[model samples]
Target chain A: MTRAVTIIGLLLTVIIGAGTYWVSHEVERLEKRYAGIQSEILAEQESIHVLQAEWSYLNNPERIERLSQEYLSLAQIDTLQMASIDDLPENADQHLYRLDKFGEAVAFLPVPRTRPGDLMPDEAAEAMIIDAPSVANAGGNQ
Target chain B: MSFMRFSYWLRGDRPELRPEQRERLAIETARNRIFITGAMFFVGFTWISYGLLDASVLRQGNEPAVASGTDTRELKTERADIVDRNGILLATDLPTNSLYADARVVKDPVESADLLLTALPDLDRDTLIRHLSSRKAFVWLRRNLTPEQQYQVNSLGIPGLNFQREERRVYPHGRLFAHTLGFTDIDNNGIAGVEREFDNELRINNGPLQLSLDTRVQYALEEEVQKAMETYSAAGAAGLVMDVYTGEVIGMTSLPDFDPHRPGQAPADARFNRTTLGVYEMGSVFKLFNTAIALETGSANLNSVFDATEPLRIARFSIRDYHAENRWLTVPEILVHSSNIGSARMAMAFGGETQQKYLKKLGMLEKPEIELPEVGGPLLPHPWREINTMTISYGHGIAVTPLQVVNGISTIVNGGIRRPSTIVKQDGAPAGERVFSRKTSDLMRRLMRLVVTDGSGKKAEVAGYFLGGKTGTSEKLVNGRYVKNARMSTFVAAFPMQDPKYVVLVTLDEPKGTKETYGFATAGWVSAPAVGKVVTRIAPLLGIEPANAKAPEIEQALQIELRKGERKLASF
Candidate 1:
């Protein structure tokens, strides 16, 4: 009985020794991986710094102006052509009827635009609610 | 017990085995085996304990370090970047490696120098060889290597050659922001302009500095002024755009501007910041102040008349109008015709003390209030004499920088409040001290508009903008005398004049007569058209809506009466 207990105790000691060694080796590997990730972060930051400088160089205003002049057909927006929607003449029929400074008639169909940013908070919420019911209707049919 | 057992095992006499003696022998043998087993267990526990103590307390496992390399050093820039109000980059620092020779390790100096010359031809061979041959531990071979050049040198792999990590200040817009952002030295120290103004903060802060200047507006101003300078053949040109209420300088440009990246290669004339550093007699632009001061002091009203029938004679000097009106002129007409005699008489009515006090309040007599080191103070006459005040009334005798004029005009039109002009962006207008009553500013605005409509500044009129301005043509002083042909033509204007929101000033130094100008080099001919062009282009960019110039409200706001309200000033 004494021999059997002694043998069992020796076997357990060997097993614990192997387990401790395996854990220490695993810890070393994880430490190495942590170091690699730290270095990679440093490298990414350096590249980003360089790219920012390059981006500014390419986005030069003088160059962009020249390129626009060469390639683009769009001209600068005139102040007369811009007016807040509220400043536009209120037409009960939602028709375009405008008179310029010369008292000459100019007409164009006023395209109704529904921009999210232009909507008031309450109006935007109402729009979302209306959209949700349509989606629910499709789901119910499916 | 251990010693006694050992002795018994090595007993002095041997014993013959009896029944009890034999039993005793077996028990003794068993007890000895147990003792041996206990000793083995104690030894095993001591070994395990020593191992645990060593691992946890006695000896620490060395942590693997983030390897020492260039990546670690390049993580931070030495100086912060500079950007416009729109977050457009104007000046920035890029990581670069400077070549240095560990001279002690260099084996073949001549060969290495030859190879380095192939890559960097700008470096002097003699100096490089000498640096490489030195016995010292380190010697600088070249500074600020471009990435391509650095790659070439690294590929060469010559012994003792290494790169010391460094940063270089780069202005990618080239000459666009030369006088504003300035440049830095090789050691990355700010040398001038905003770079110099906030050098200490830039070195420590990680975020880019945002200036009040708009890059788009700056480019527009520069391009227009450059074209005008070429067309008029002016010696140089300078201009600025200021927010009337906030005193924030949106765009400013001085012609013959140098590239900030290669400041050393630029000529001295190109390096000079004319807007802030060069002081000049700003000609008739000062009459705007005179009119405002006259109204503010209650010495003159729109209908108050000063005689322009003949040149006003002062001791050893005669002040004459550039265009002789040769008649009695109302106060508004005085500014309209730029009548020197009438302006002098108006100045005398207020006297020298009041003129000095008002100009001081406008910040005209002090150094330019800006964020540039290259700035000059106004050249005021030594004594506050009556003649000095008279000459200054028509923008002569005293000299001031263009920055002062823009700021002063902003003060007059911005509800008669004086705020310091700043190159740093502000979220809102700063609180300013009241210099003149709001009513005086309103009258001044109306009178200035009349100048654009019916006076010498008719060429500056933009149909829908109600542009108002005063044209100034002053003869350049040469050899102690004013030369007639060599003139500095200047026009200072504010747009949508009913409630003036912007002040734009354009000055041409020694502009010659052009064929298109009908052989006239006056401010009305040379600079007024440029001011008009600038306003028309920049107004839309500045988000100002165009209103009909003939609209009833605008017409009423800009209307002024002449000859005691009997007749209104008429526009042709």
Candidate 2:
């Protein structure tokens, strides 16, 4: 009887030990996966930060204005310049074509050298550049 | 028998009824007890393992026994509202009931379809009849039903009739900004416009989508262009307004526009985006760029002169001026006069390769980089033969979209920075790619002003604000040939030309001359006046003070010079 009791106790102990080992292994694997998720989440958060900064940098109004003038050399146009065909020059070649340096074909416009102050701030510029009229509401040419 | 032999014999099978038998019985009892106890422990362990698993899954909400069907997921998200930049609701998702049926449970298919058609007269009875009679387990009777229809359908309550929740995309503004804002399909998928471009990002996020476009600006721009279209009896018109600094597209409209809500009903041509998508041979507008390119490359200066006395003929093609002055014209005069011969001569002087390089740098020889799905690729001449160079100098042999011209002009007037145009409201974006030299850009700005004040674009001017632009008139190509009667009239202009903040481009396709415009459908007659009206309307809204109303000092530098004699260079 005593021997029978010993065998039964040994079997019980083996079962419990095996179950414990299996559970511990599973738990370890889960913890590793959890850690991986945490790191990835951190990386995404960093990327968002970068994107926000990039957006702000790209849409700066002062910078864009500076660049526009530096590149296109366009000034505010005048009413006379925007006249109708009735007022057009008599000759077709008088307003027909011009040469381009890059050698590609292009239409031509005479340069307007009107200064900055002549422009009136339009909704197109105010709404586009800063996107907020309340903060920067000056309408006259800068 | 000896005592040992007797014991051995007694221990044998014959001793079962003796003391040995009693001992064996006790051992068997203990072994049975152990076996029972082990079985109980094993069973208990198994039960505990199963219980733990059940608890784990239940805690994680992964219970397999619970059936989570379509109804649950359907109720999770309310549809998002779509609004214009000015807080005008263009589209909205409203809660509506939809009819569904379990075909297996339906007893009378014909009767049910008849009842459904009565409740929703828009539905075709024959089609519904077939669908309801199908062997399929489930079928959709109707989607996006009105409350009244839902009630009527439910009252009939044919056993299989079921009401399901669904969303419908609604466009409140109808057709105003249809082509630009775009519309969602039946499944609420954005197939075009700003919606398609930013589809994934906009799906779950319901925050206001701030666009660069202004509703008022859009209205004004559209109204003027439409007026021009009607007056000139034109085929179509397209106009765009852009912020010079940030490259934000404020108002873009194309005639023959379709209502996004009813895109399928509109003709394909009306749905086309002429501003950013349609590549046209933009006529004399090319000359502006050509002149800028020349000045930028040190091939010429404002004081330099080109001989326009005779047309330059090469092979079979002749490059001549429509209005031949037959005399020497200075660099500025060539642009103001729009002298094709003079410009071509200057191009030959600069050489083909140099001109190609500069135009590419100015974002003219490629597709304009804008945040839209309908961008047109630049129509460049292959092999770039010498004839191509000559024709290109006068806005022929190559084609580009209106947006490219705007960007090109922006590069010139915005001090040579080729900022990529954007539709989304970027409070502060990065400095886009630099495409030109500042000096070249400045020189180009002066030339553009000369055109508007003393050149063909005089009609595009706004008195109070110094406006400068170039007018272009190109014959539309039809079936591999240029149609003589049809022309695309275009104007590109900037305000306060000295330091440009905005560029406005207007185009009319195949317009017929009206008596008011002196039988002329040229850009100076059609597009120029349209831009003028736009500038007049939006000027007040944009906070630009009228010239007479503005404080005095601000207008000090605004001058329109008409010089008859040679003017000496005033050194900066």
lDDT of 2: 0.74
In candidate 1, which residue ranges exceed 4 Å CA deviation? A1-32, A76-142, B1-75, B102-114, B121-139, B478-481, B562-572
Runs off by more than 4 Å, candidate 2: A1-142, B1-92, B102-119, B125-137, B151-159, B204-208, B436-440, B549-572
Whole-model lDDT values for every prediction: 0.83, 0.74
Give the docking tier of candidate 2. Answer: incorrect
lDDT per residue (tens digit) for residues B289-322 in model 2: 8887787778887667677778889989888886
| Fnat across every predicted model, in order | 0.26, 0.04
**Candidate 1, residues B1-572: lDDT per residue as tens digits?**
77776675575212446767867777777788789999999999999999988877777655335544443334567888888888888888888899999999999999989998988998999988888898779898888888899999999889999999887898878888888888888888998888898999899966888888988888888887888889989999998999988888999999888888888998889888889998888889899999899999999987777777789998998998866878888888788778899999999999999999999999998998888888999888888788999999999988899889998888888789989989889889999989989999888888888888778887787656778888888888776578877888888899889889999989999887665665677898779988988887888778776775445687789878754212234510
Tens digit per residue, CA lDDT, model 2, A52-108: 434433433334546878998875444334433443456756655676898866776
DockQ of 1: 0.11
**DockQ (Cα-based) for each candidate:** 0.11, 0.03
| DockQ category of candidate 1 | incorrect
Q: In candidate 2 chain B, where is summed lDDT lowest over 10 consecutive residues?
A: B69-78
